[model samples]
Target: MDTRNKKRLGAMLLTGIVSLSAIASGCGNNAADDANAGANEQPANAATENAVAGAGMKDGKYDPPITITYLRPWGPDVKFKDGENQDNNVHAKWASEKLGIELKNQWISPSTNNAFETKLRLSLATNEPMPDIISYRGDFNLVRELIDSGRFVDAGELFDKYASETWKKAMDEDPSVWYPYMQDGKRIGIPILDYAYNGDPVMWIREDWMKKLGLSAPKTLDDLEKVMDAFANQDPDGNGKKDTYGLAIGFKNWINTWMSDAGWIFGAFGTMSNQWNLSADGKLEYGSVTPGAKQALATLQDWMGKGYLPTEAGLYDETKAAEDFTAGKAGIVVGPHWMPAWPLEDVKKNNKDAQYKAYPVPSGPNGQAGRHGTSNANGVVLINKDMAHPEAFFTYQNYLFDQFANPPIGGEFEYGLAEGYDWVMVDGKPTTDAAHTGGFAPEKYTITFDGARIPGLNMATLAKLADGGEAATPFEKKLKLSTPQTMLDAAKIVLEQKDITMQQLFTGAPTATMQMNNDILAKMEKDTFSQIIYGKAPIDSFDAFVEKWKASGGDQITREVNEWYQSVSGGQ
Candidate 1:
């Protein structure tokens, strides 16, 4: 969390806050600097022109070494493993050799929930010369602040002039990528691309139990009840014990907490994210207090009443909830396809014969089953002003994103970061198999959300990939074996059923109302919902809570959100 959120729980007393002043629009202006540049030119070493001309540039050579400082946020998992020098990593080495670029260490923070943002803001506040390029993956608010400062140059021309064909093609593939980085009409940084279906969630189940119980896959809410009943009472664990539960869900402060983690359940009963398709209107609608949300809550109440869900689920952190699923105490859960890699994969170790699979969430009462999620489009990139050679950053970044990030063909990527660091060569091959990933960041290396080798996918295949199944390639094959067929199948069903779902159109900064009421409203929703499920609160409380939600800034938030949605839809 940032200092703002930190003040509440009040964790640690901060060291200090740095404040920066605005300088003229160029990099560190000094009159003596021009004299130094003129003296260092050395007449361009005339012979170099022949070589540079052959390389397809105006001159045979560009003289003088220029340094670019870059920043990226990584945590403990990336603490320079295998006796590697702290100053150098695979990425820095590649940048130096291939692009004639030298990247100075800016510093690496813990990469915690909001540590990156804190670090970024502090750096921005300091007047010490800013880095020539900043790969900002922190927050949009910070990005906006950076643009408004005008210290960095606009990248529109740089991208057009310097981006490689491959990189250009990728950007062309997704026009919306530029939306978040745009301020007034200027593009400040390149938008980072991620899987289009990164938001899709899948229903993971213990397939062996389904087979043993002779139970067909669940389609409707009624069928889901049967499955949950079988899971809870049928002794699915077969340890000859009744200690098992139907599913796992948690309510924690971490990302993908209760609302984040349990959104699928609501999505199934139908309340996930701020987006939904209302039966009353063919147009998309928010789901918070809609009728479908009420139904979803009702289902939660029923599950809690029947003891099908954990009584203590409301207190579960994401880690604890995943453990319940992994320990074989819960027969079903929902998560992304990569669950087999980190959080959910422990099931194999816990019970070697446990049959786990991914399947679609059970259909809703009106056959409107859908999962909710948001896509990632923005990270951070560095920008330069008055570059004698403005093209270098673009070319280097393009090569990194195209050949390195989304390799067209299978090739060893430069930004591989490091093999043994995050991935390892098992028998001379790239394997995303967790066993080979040694020295990964303690928090990440093993997790799919970080730098892990996933397989090839195009926009068209996103729905299919999100559906989960057999690995798209040899790399994904290892992932598939560890994950269950049901997991993959569930992902496919959810992706294929996208027609019934609507991702929240508002993907920008939090509105003022959200800033004021987001925390309280969320806490109210979770507390009330949890109470109703645990039988601590009457069902009517949901109605009262809804009224409170609307009265307490929710109405204002809704209006602002719809305004954004309409703006994005061109007022359609």
Candidate 2:
């Protein structure tokens, strides 16, 4: 392989160079040495070799300055207190001073969802130059179309080549991360791995009412009934007046949808509402119209008749229902752990005597209490086909994962973005309760978007919800700020109830017909389920809905889902 060895055999073996190049393909060849011997070496990637030179890092803070063109689906009025520019925010600013990278807004507006898609498609259609990077986080239909356009590069190899160990570990934790971008043997974009259990709804109750009413914590459906009965009739507030309802459940799109869904009650009855799933026999089944749902509906109807459920529940969203519970007008509500930071916090502030606690969804018939939820599936960095610097993306991402995401020693995560921007030492302490003029925006991720102090929502906020502790940093200490007593209580219940958690992880892409007729099928399902719940139709009417659902493209959707599974699994 050396020049001297090659020269000894070269007079009649001029083809040796071709064989050596093939042998050196796996490991890197020394380009300089090869070029000195008249071997051709390309000069296009020379810029990538020097990409990290001007990047920022000093002590623990990212120094220097680097800018990125970022895009996300947000309208102009999408509120940011510390934001001055349409494109950049505190997060991007922190990335500049802390990570030495700045994010410039390439384009932003109300059209982020549809407008972004149209813009991207038109650019591709017109053969316009693409940006340095595109982080696609929109509808899957567009993602699938992007792959077909062949304008993006495969990110899988680059990830293996340059991704930091911390980021790699994150990817390794879930193989499902590769689902969206893979086509045959090619991968066009990096799958964004968001947090799990965004839909794990837990039960919250007023501990103050429990103590005042001589009531014990409910552990089963029967016990829950008794508790609800008490909340309906007994003046639990001890004012000798009946003013509260047993539960503040809402029926809006948000209530029955992912994350804030109240479908846990259906799980008790052996049904899962609003999910497309495959059962033990491998056939796709809709859980909403089954006999189990009938049982669940019966229980709900009885509660409604007993005045245990608020009449306004049919009209409330999680926010409004939470407002009712926090205002002491309802005894129970269901939500995720972050509830403590928002509506639940308002409840605690409204009444100092209002003590609340979280509990698992009560056990149902057959002694099972189940809930439906799943991890997030989007928001990763994607590469354009003509983008010159894949290494630059990896280098910047490596620092983010190593320095911000994964904490070793000398980690700045505990301090938030920086001491002066988002946090400050007031007489030598970090305080969110106090005010700092133009200091880092007091609001956490709920506030900023430009560069963002948050690495990702699922990574930062949701991770903290899981690792809440009495011993937290100025960063970690935020977990203890002003969460309502109810949300903290509900999280405890969720920890215990996690055993029955189920997610339809393999639901896959919507079928061609589903993509076209889902609106119709969804409306049918909603109308049928609503009628059954309201007694406008007998439980037997569910049979008609089932037959009609199958006829209306649901069957085709199931097969397409199966086909996608086989495709992604390589027909495993």
Tens-digit lDDT string for candidate 1 (1-572): 32122221111111000000000011111211321232223232232333233333343222344455556655433445565433465555655665565656556555677786787778778855556666655455677777767777778666766555544544554455565566556677766544444435567788888899999888777887898899899888777888988878865442233111566556665556434333344344557677667777777888878878887787786558778888888888876544554456678898788777766666776666666543434255657564444455554454444443333324453213456654567787765454666534321221111331111132223223334433343223333334344434444554455454445455545668988888898888767777777778887888998899899998888777666545444444
| Predicted structure 2, TM vs. truth | 0.76
Quantify how close model 2 is to the true structure by its C-alpha RMSD in Å: 15.4
Model 2: CA > 4 A from native? 1-68, 74-104, 110-127, 136-140, 238-242, 258-260, 282-284, 348-350, 376-378, 412-414, 430-434, 437-489, 570-572
Our tally of clashes for model 1 stands at: 21
Clashes of 2: 15
TM-score of each: 0.75, 0.76
Model 2 lDDT-worst window of ten? 19-28
Model 2 misses residue 150 by how many Å? 2.8
